[model samples]
Target: MFTRILTSALFAGAAAGLIAALLQLVFVQPVLLHAELYEGGELVHFGGDSTVPAEQDLGGLSPVRDGLSIVFTMMIYSGYALILVPLMALAQERGARIGARTGLIWGLCGFIVVHFAPGFTLAPEVPGVAAADVGLRQVWWFATVLAAAVALWLVAFGRGWAAWGPAVVLLAAPHLVGAPEPEVFTGPVPTEIGALFAARAFGVGMAAWVMLGGFAGHFWARETAGRDAAAQPA
Candidate 1:
């Protein structure tokens, strides 16, 4: 079981990590860049002798920072996978029957609940800065999850196409509604930095959860199959 879980996690984690990276690079980066261009311009024009420092010219140091970031990110995802795989097993034991696809959905749902929803309120910013009010964000997150779960459940249990719609809706909803951008134009850090961070965080966290779910699903499937085979009259 441990071996199965580890193998499944590794495979799922790799795929999930790739997807997460793509999301950040494709969706999140563009949004943050646009926000930065818009808000930063305003700050420069209005602040009249702006006190904000120039963006950090990290130069060669960027590679180092990026490497460390990747290492830490992977570590976080791996840890998350370890925790989630067992939960998935327990869910399966309870007759949840969460296959690979459903596992992915469950993982994504978890991500939305933990990172994205909380982010709506926290509105990522520098440590000292006040985050935006999270109440509305929390509500939206809950609503979205409930809607998605119902849709997925209907599809999974009802054996219908309608469930796919909810899955699609779940995947696209976050991108459509978008995460909150930082309002205040702070120091050297670009305003869009916050948004970028939020997006990356969301993407990475979701990816981690998805990978974990996949692994869990695989383990469950294998274990169930083995049990059934063992019970069959030889």
Candidate 2:
């Protein structure tokens, strides 16, 4: 049973991760490159003498980087699938529906857990943006993800308000506590560019997460169906 689930997770995760990497290159990397211009003093904010070097212009789109992106994405999404698929099975056992629809819902829940929940405080960082220490941000981010995931699970699977009320609190706790802030809000990137980066980053993440859930659900359903068939009387 675990083997089947693991196999489904690996397949679905790889597919979703590959798709995500492609989407990130298309949607997110350009902005990231642009932000680098400001960070590296190659392009000034607002208005200035800007002649972006050819090297800087195309630096963000690298074949090697893209390869790494795909590899990292695959590993990350596969890890997520490994965790999610089992929870999905448990949810099904507990009478929740388990299919694409539920999977999509779960995916959205995942986004809320990792992205939106943390985003409320941290937001996405652009290359030129200056903010909080990396270590502090990571600590907060991990805590937020944990809190949000548990909160979502409780609300989704818990029996009643007794469970749900606390879920809401958990969801709010991290935000209420707030994310780590930099000593000063300073960056070379424009407010508009930074804002756009954050929005696009979230958009890309949402897309990837949705795809992850959809694929995982599809594969999981198929594998479980096969198992059920094998167990049935001939």
Candidate 3:
């Protein structure tokens, strides 16, 4: 059981993470680097002297930095898969079908739970964006993620209003309490760039999560089947 979970999670997570890292580099990094320029006073929003570079340095193509990024991304997705595969197994035990298609739905739910849910309150930030106290925000973020995770699980597996009623409350409770806010909204990054970064980040997250779920489902099913077959008369 341990081996199955580890292998499935690692394979699925690594594959998904690799792709996600590439996508983030292509679609998200430029916006981030641009935002940093503003944050660092290298670029001014309205100053006549400031001109957008034809191409941003993008960290000078540092292999070490980029390589570490890929590895870190893989680790993160692998961690997510570690959580997801066990859940998949549990779901299967409860008669839930596991497959690539189903996994896509699961992936979407995961995205909603982890990214969209917290983001709905906090939104993604760039380098210069003014925000709440870090410790306070971290507390709120963790609570929100936990609440969202429970709500989703209950909604998925629990039966009738008994399960759903609480799910709704759990889902709404955090938002009602609200996330910590800055004393005042302030930041060096352009609103447009921040907005674009948030949008692209969410988009890339959705894609990565869907792929992760599909790969996880595929591998989990295959591993389980193989184990079962090995146990059968032979």
Candidate 4:
């Protein structure tokens, strides 16, 4: 069982890392670049030189940032899997069955509870970097949560709650203890642009989380099956 859990976690972590990389390249990077351009305009508005590089670029966060991002992404996924595997194992021990659809719902529900719940809030923006103001972003957060809930409910075949409960608790525990305040980073960018950056960050982070859950759940199921098979053999 330990071996199976470890194997599943490794696979899920790798998948999460890969997805994070893709998201960073395809979605996050482009959004940041656009925000940078917007900030340049704002700088010019203030009669400051528009040539200053964006905080993301100027932070000298090149390859190191990329590596750290991947590491963190993997850690989040693996941690989730670790939290969930025991619950799943218990369910299996009790003869509960979970399908792919069920897992998807669980993933989505977990996403909503963790990301949209009022108990958890965004951290402060770093100095000199335009990022979203912490807390919910008006109606968008509500709307997005609603849409995602419906989508996940459908995809998870309505079993999301059962499969995701333990994982959700695990994820939220730290937040319940209190997350660090958002850092107040000064930026050459306008507040609007900072808000946009914050939104994008949330989107990307959530997307990665859901993808992580899905992959982890799938592999966990596989691991359980293998364990059961081994136990049944002569």
Candidate 5:
């Protein structure tokens, strides 16, 4: 079972990560490069003195950087898979169906727990955004993700008000306490560019997660069946 879980997660995570890398390169990278121009004072917004050149191209792709990005994304997604597959097993043990179609829903839930929950209070930031202390933000982000995950599980699988009641509180607790914030919000990145970056980031994330869930489910089913077959009489 342990071997099955590890192998399935690695294979699924690698496939999904590749897809995610392509999507980020195409959709998210250009917006990031554009925002960096503002951060570096090359492009000024709101009528500031600027050193802007006409027909500027936001092309900063490099082989080394992109290669590293691909590798990093794969590792990150694989880590995410390690968390996700065990939960799928638990859900199966509790009599929940697991398959490609259902995995899409699982993937969406994983996205909500890991990404959307934290992002609700702390939206994705550009290079030059004003923000809270890094340590505080990291603490809050992890707490929110943990709270959201437990809350979601209770809502999905828990029985009666005993479970439902705590689930609601868990979901609300993080938001009620609130995320740390800057005293005054200010940044060189324009609102339009920032908004676009956030949107694209969410889009790419959803696409990757959906693929991860499907692949993970498929591999899990395959491995389990293989094991069962091996144990059966000839």
Candidate 6:
């Protein structure tokens, strides 16, 4: 059973990751490239009380960088898939349906837990932007993710208001607790550019997660069907 699940996760995750990489190349990479210009001093938001021609930082989109980016995306998304598939298994045991359809919803829910929920306080950042300390941000992020995950599980699988009430509280906990804040909003990047970058990043993530969930669910169902047929008396 574990082997089946792992195999399904690998194949599905690789496919989804590749799809996500392509998406990031098209939609997300340009924003990152733009931000890096400011970070690297190639572009100055206000230079010498007037405008000046910024140096090209096109190297951000180079073939080497793109290649490494794809590799990293694949690794990260594969990890996500591994975590997601097991949750689907748990859902299955709880008498809930688990399939490509459910997977899409689950994927979106996962997005809410990991990205959307934490984003309220964190927002996406560019290289030159101010931020809270890395260690503190990470601690807060993990706590938020965990609270949201538990809340979602309760909403999905928990029995009654007794369960539901706690779930709501858990869902609200992170927002109430709040994320660490940056002391100053100092940065060379424009607010519009930063906002756009964050939106595109989330869009790319949603696409990849949808693909991962759909593929994992579809493949796992097929694997289960194959096993059942083999066991049935001929």
All candidates' lDDT scores? 0.57, 0.85, 0.90, 0.58, 0.88, 0.84
- For model 1, the stretches where C-alpha displacement exceeds 4 angstroms are 1-7, 18-63, 126-190
- For candidate 1, what is the lDDT? 0.57
Task: List model 2 lDDT by residue over 1-234, tens digit each.
Answer: 889889989987898889888888898888888888788886775535534442444454588878898899889989999988998998878877777777888888888888899998899999867788899999999999999999999987888999999999999998898888888866987676788889998998899899889888888888878878999999
Q: 87 in model 3: Cα distance from truth in Å? A: 0.8
Number of backbone collisions per candidate: 1, 0, 0, 13, 0, 0
RMSD of each: 7.8, 2.7, 2.2, 8.3, 2.1, 2.3
The count of backbone overlaps in candidate 5 is 0
Error of 6 at 226 (Å): 1.3
Regions more than 4 Å wrong, model 2: 46-60
Candidate order by decreasing lDDT: 3, 5, 2, 6, 4, 1
TM-score to true structure, per model: 0.53, 0.92, 0.93, 0.58, 0.93, 0.92
Candidate 6's error at 192, in angstroms? 1.0
Q: Candidate 6 lDDT, tens digit per residue, 1-234?
A: 889889888888899999999999999888788887788776777635637443344554688889998998888888888898888887887777888898888888888888788886788776688888999999999998898899999888888998899999988888888888888877887666789889998888888888888988887778777987999999
Report the lDDT tens digits of candidate 5 across residue range 1-234: 798889989998999999999899999888888898888988887645544543459876888988898999999999999999999988988889887888888888888888888988888887888999999999999999999999989988999999999999988889999999999977977787899999998889999999999988888878777877999999
- Cα lDDT over the full model 3: 0.90
In model 6, pairs of residues that clash are none
Model 6 misplaced stretches (Cα beyond 4 Å): 47-60
* lDDT for residue 38 in candidate 6, whole number 0-100: 81
Comparison by TM-score, 4 against 6, better one: 6
- The TM-score-based order of candidates, best leading, equals 5, 3, 6, 2, 4, 1
Model 1 per-residue lDDT tens digits across residues 46-139 = 2446565445332232456445655555555566566566666666766777577777777876576556544554444432233335675566
Model 6 RMSD vs true structure: 2.3
